[model samples]
Target: MSVIDILVPAGDVRRMHLLVAERLAGKGHDVALVGTDAPGIARTLDNILHFERAALRIRLDSLLDAVPQPLLSLARSGAALRVDLTGSGRPVASPALAPRFAGSPSLAEAARLLMLGRLPDIAVVLDGGRPVAEASPMADSRLSVARGLDDILARVLTLLVIETHRYLDGGAMDARPAETAAPPKTPTSGQMVGTYMLSTVPRQIGGAARRLAFKLHRWNVQYRFHKGRRVADTGLMAGEPWLTLPDDGDRFYADPFPFEWNGRYFIFVEEFRHGGGKGVLSVAEVFRDGAPTVPRVILEEPYHLSYPQVFAHGGQIWMLPEGGAGGNLVLYRAESFPDRWVRHSVLVPGRQLFDSTLLEHDGRLWLFATERDGYGSASDMLVVYHAPALEGPWTPHQANPVRIDRAAARPGGRFVRVGDRLVLPVQDGTLEYGGALGLADLIELNETKVRLTEPVPILSPIRSTYPKIHTLNSSEHLETVDCIAPMLRGGLRRAG
Candidate 1:
C-alpha cells in the first residue's frame, strides 16, 4: 500500500479526517489526522492516527481576528493576493509574509507557510492562493470520493482560509458553475418585495391564503443525470468529465414526490423536457403511494422552475417554485388540475433563494433556502424564514443564515423531523462530484444544528448506463455551442 502524508489543519471538518481515515483505512492506508485539540474528534477506522497540538488556524485567527478589515492585515496573516471584502465583506489583510509564491498555480507553498513556516521543495510551493478552486462559474473539475472529516478546529481553520480566499483573496478557490445562461427574466413580485426571496410574505395578503399557500408541501421533481453524450463512464477512469456517457444521446428522466394534496398524495415534479430547457415545473397524477404516473406541466415559467413545494390550506393547492432572481417567494394556486397554476402573491421576496423548502415546527412555519449573491453556489449557506400564518406576515430567523457548507450545502431531496429533532438531508456540491447525501440536526423552529457539520463525500462517479454531458442554458442557444437543432442532450431537446 502506498502511504501518502496528507497535510491538513487539525480542526477542520470540511477536511474531515475521521471519515477520511475510515475511507483510507478501507483502501489500506495509514491515515493520520493532525490538528489543534478542540471540541470534537472521532475514529471510525483502525488505520488512523490523531496528532493534536497548537495548530495553524488558531495562530492565524488569533493574529487576524483583532486586526479589523484591512488589506495590510492579510499580508501579515500569510496571504499573497489580498482581496479585501471586509468593508462589504472583510477587507483587512496582513502583508509582509514574504511573497515566495509569486506566480505558482498550487497552494502548497501558501499552505506550508501557514503551517510550518517553511516546507520542503515540493511541500511548500505557492500557486495562485485559490482558497476554493471549484468557485469558478464555468471551470468544471471536481474531487469526488465515495464516502466522507476530521478536526473540529480543522474545519474552523479551513473556513478561515476558505472565507479568506473567497471574500479576501477573491475566489482563489471558487466552484465551477454547474449550469449556466438562462436569460435574465423579469422577476415578478408576488406582492412582497425585497429584491429576492427569503421565506416571508407581505402583510397585504390574506390569512387563509397564507395558511393554504405556505403550508408544508412536498412536490416531485425530475433529476436528470448524464442526459447526453457517451464515453466509458463519461471519462470515469480518470476524474475527467462528470457526465458518464459521451457517445450516447440524452434521456427522459422523472420522479414523483408524494405531497398532501387535498388530503391525498399528489405527485409533482419537473416534467421530462425533450426540447425545453432545464428549469420547468409541473404536476401530475399522484400514484397510489405518491409516485409519479404521467407528469404534465401545470405551470411553466421563462426561467428554470424546479423543486415544487406544495401544500393545501382552505381547500386550495398552493405552490412555490425555486424562484431565482424573483425576490419574495411567490405563491401559486392551481386554477385547475395538472394544467392551470395561477400566480398568487409573494411568500418571501428580494433575497436570492435557490432551493426553498418549507415545514412547520413548534407552532411556527419554517422555510429553508440557500441564499447568496447568486445561484449555483446554493449549497454553501442556508437561510431560514418563518411565519405565523402562511401568508399574513413572514419573518427571517434571528440567525438567518443558519449554516455554511461547501459540501452538502444545497438542500437535498427533503427535510424531515425525525423523532424530536429536525433532520435535513442536503447535497454536497463539490463542483462536479459527490451528489451524495448528508444529514443534519435541526435544533428548533429557527435554529439549525448539523451533524458531521461539513460536506461529506457520499457518491462518486461510476460508469453509468445513462447518457451524461447534459448542459441546459435557457438564455443561450444551441447554435451558439455548435449543436444541431434536433440534437437531444441531457434530456433537453430543441423547442419546435
Candidate 2:
C-alpha cells in the first residue's frame, strides 16, 4: 500500500472528494485529504442547477447531492484532515482540478462543455506534471444540461478512484501530453449565469413538448434486403426503399438479429407490447419470394428481455438474450426449434449487463457487454469476459472496462467477420439512444488489452426517414436492421 494525498478546495468539499478518499482507502492505501486555497463556484452553479431542475421536472438523485452534515463533519476530522498543505511529498491527485476555472476548474469546465452541447472527454490525471492515467467518464446525455453535469461529475469521481488504483498497481501511464493548466476563454460569473438562464429555458420547453409527443407516438424497427450483397458490405443508403415491420398500434419490434439455418432465413427481435411495457424474445421467418411471416413469441420471462443473439453450437441452437432486468446474463437452448427454450446456464450473474454480444477468436470465447453501474448510461462502458469454452468458467479481462466511450461502446449486433478483419456493429448514443449505427474493426484483443479502430458511422437518423437505427445484422441472402419510427396516435401514418 502507498500513501496518497488528494487535493480539494478548502471549505467547499463535495461528496466526490470524500468518495475518492474512501475508494483509495478501500484499495488498501493510506489516503489523506489536502485542502487547497481556491475559491468555489459551487454555490452559484447549484443555484442555476436548482432552477433548471425545477423548470425541467428532473427528479433523479445524483452523487452531486450535498453530503449529510454529520458525514461532512466526520470527514473533516478523524483521518480526513482538511488542512492547508501543498507539496505533500507523497503522491497527490485531484479530481476537481482541471485547466479552466479561475477557482474550481473541473466544475467550471464541465459547465462550459454542457453549455456548448459537448460531451466531456476523459479526465487526465497527472502526477508531478506527467500524465499518469486517463479516465473516460460518462453520464446520460439525454437529460437536461444540469443533470448531465451532475451525473458526469459522479462518474468522473468514480473513474478517478479506479484510475488512481490502476496507476498505483503499476498500470501503464498515459503517453499523451498533459493539458496546459491555464484557462482560455474563461467566462465571468455573470456570463456563466446569464448564458444558462437565457439558453436552457427554451431547450427545456422544447424537451417537454417532445416528451408529450412521445407518449402519443412510439418507435418501430425497419428492414431492407440487400439482394446478394451484405448491408455491411454496402452501407445503408438514404432514401433507399425499406420495409417497416407491421405493428398493431399497441406493440413494436426492435433489436433485429438475423440468422440462417438449413437454407431458411429468420429475424429475431425484442417484442414489446404497450400494455405490458416489457419486452420478450420473438422471431419471424423471411421469404425472399413472398411476404414475411408474423413474428411469433419465442421466449418470455417475468422480467424484461431483448437482444436475441442466437447461434448454433455443438449441433444445438443456443440463444443469449439480454436479461438485465433479471439481474444476470443467461444462456438458453432450444428444446424445440423456434419456440421452446430451456435454461442452459448463467454466464454472468448479479449484474445488469446490457446488449451482451459474443465472439470466438484464438481458441477463446469472448463476451462483451455494457454494465449498468447504478449511474450513468449503460451505453458507455464495455466490459469483456473470456472463457476457454462456451460455458463453465468465465474470467473478466484484467482491464474489465477496456473501453469507455459513449459513441461506440454498446454492441449493436453480432460480430461480423469480413475477409481478414472482424467488425462490430455499435450504437452511437452520444446524442440519444439508438440515434445512429456504425461499424468498428477489432484491431487487437488479449488477456490484458483490447483495441478497436475508430468507428465509421454507416446509418443515422439525419440521413433517413427513420429517426434512429441501432441494430444491424445479415444472413447470406438477406440483411436486416431496426430503426425508430414515430407513429401517430390512433393512426397508421408516421408522426410529425
Candidate 3:
C-alpha cells in the first residue's frame, strides 16, 4: 500500500484536516496525519485570526436564534452568504476545532518523513489558515459556533481524490523547503448582510421584519417548451410563451419531470404544502397551447418527497422521486397510468440521496445523485452508482464522487443526448439552493471511470423574473423547465 503523510498546522485539531486524512486512509492508502509548527513564508495568518471570525459568526447566529424558522429561512435566502472559497479565500471560523497535539518540528522534517523513507510516498498539507470555506445557507446564524465546516471537509476530500488520481496517473510528489514566518496581512471583510446585522438590536428587528416580508412569497415551478428533440438554450424557443402552473397560497409545486407516453405529455412534480412542510408527487397534463391541466396528487408519503424523477422502461412507468429525507433512494412503479403508484424497490438504502437521476447507456444503467455522506452539503458532490438493470445490486463507482462542484453537482433534469454527448442539466446551488441551471457534457462515463466537461450555463433565474430554475426536462418534440419565484400575501392574510 502507498503511504501518505497528511501535514496539518501544529496546535490545531479541526475535523477539516482529520476528515481528509480519514478519507485517504479509507481509500486503502496508509496515511500518517502529522502536524508541524513551521510557519510558511509569505504567510502569517494563524489560529488566532480564525478564532475571531468564528466568534463573530457564533455571536451572530446566537442572535438569529430568537427569530422564527419561517422568517429565518426567508432572511438566509436573500443573504446568500455562502461565498465560494476554493483557494486562498478567507474562510469563516470552524467550531469543530479539537485540542492539538504537542508541538512538533518544521515542515522540513515532515518532508523528510516522506522523501527520505519508503514508508510515506506522499505528504499533504491541510493548513489552518482557512478552516471553513463556503458556508451552508441552512446553518443557523444564532449559534456561538462556526457552522458549515462540513463544506470545507467535503472540499478537502475532493482535493485528495484529485491528487490521488494525479498520482496514479504517473504524477510525482514534490516536497519543497518550508519558509519562515512572515508578518500577517490585514484581514478583509466579506460578511453576509444578515450575519453582520444580527449583532445589533435595531438591525436585528429590521432584519426580522424584512425577512417576514420576504416570507410572504414562496417558490412555484414554471415551464416553457420547444418543438424539438432537445434545445439547450431558451433563446432557441424565443417566441414560445412560458407557462406556469398556478399555485394556491396553501401549496406550491416545483421540480417538474415531463415524459411523453401514448401521444400525450405528462408532468410529474413535487407538490408541497407550506403548512405541512412535506412534499408529495403530483401529475398534470400539458396542452399544446402551453397550458397545464390542474395538477392532482398522484403519490403521497409520510416523508418529504420531491423531484419526481419519472421515466418509462420495459413498457412500464417508473418513478424515483427524491426520498432523501426518508434516508434512501426508492423506486415507485406506476400501477396505473399517472395516478396509482406502488413502491417498486429500494435502489439504494440507508442514505440521504437527492435528485436521483437515471440514464440507460450501452446495456448498463447509470444512476447519478447528490448523496449526503454524513458530511457536507448535498448539492456539492456528484456520486454515481451503476447496475446491470434498472433495479437491484447497484455498485458505486470507483471514484464515487466523480465531481465536486457547487455550481454543477446536483442533477437537475433528464439527460439530453447531443451529437454523441450526453448533456445534463444541473443546479448551480453556489449562490443559493436551486439558483440556476448549468449544462455539463458527460465526457467519459463507465463503471470504473466518470468524467464531465466544464459546465456551460444554459438557464439563469436572473434573466427572467424567477429567482430559481433547477430542473429541466425534454422529450422528442417537447421541452419543459421549472422555475421558482416569491409569492406575495397580505398581513391579515398571513395570519389566517
Top candidate by TM-score: 2
Q: After superposition, how far is residue 57 of candidate 3 from its true place, in Å?
A: 12
lDDT tens digits by residue: candidate 2, 1-496: 6666666556566666677778778889877766655554446667877777786677867656655441322222333212222212233333222221212234655675676556666454343344344444555653377667766765565566666676666766654544676533445667678767666556666766765565432466666666655656655444345677787777888888878888877888999887796899999887765367889999999999999998988789999998888888999998988788999999988888999999999989999898866567678788999999888488888887777778878899989888798999988877677777888999999888889887888844354567566788776666667876765555555532
How much is 45 displaced in model 2, in angstroms?
1.3
TM-score for each predicted model, relative to the true structure: 0.45, 0.85, 0.69
Q: Best lDDT goes to which candidate?
A: 2
Pick the winner on lDDT between candidates 1 and 3: 3
CA lDDT of every candidate: 0.37, 0.70, 0.58
By summed lDDT, which 10 consecutive residues of candidate 2 come out lowest?
Answer: 80-89
Tell me the spans in candidate 2 whose CA falls farther than 4 Å from its real position: 9-13, 32-41, 70-104, 128-138, 172-187, 214-218, 238-241, 459-463, 492-496
For residues 218-315, write the lDDT of model 1, one tens digit per residue. Answer: 11122212223211112221222322111113223232234544444344554434345564665545333324355556767766676666666667
Candidate 2 to truth, TM: 0.85
How many clashes show up per model? 99, 0, 7
User: What local lDDT does model 3 show for residue 240?
Assistant: 57
Q: Residue 450 deviation, candidate 1, in Å?
A: 8.7
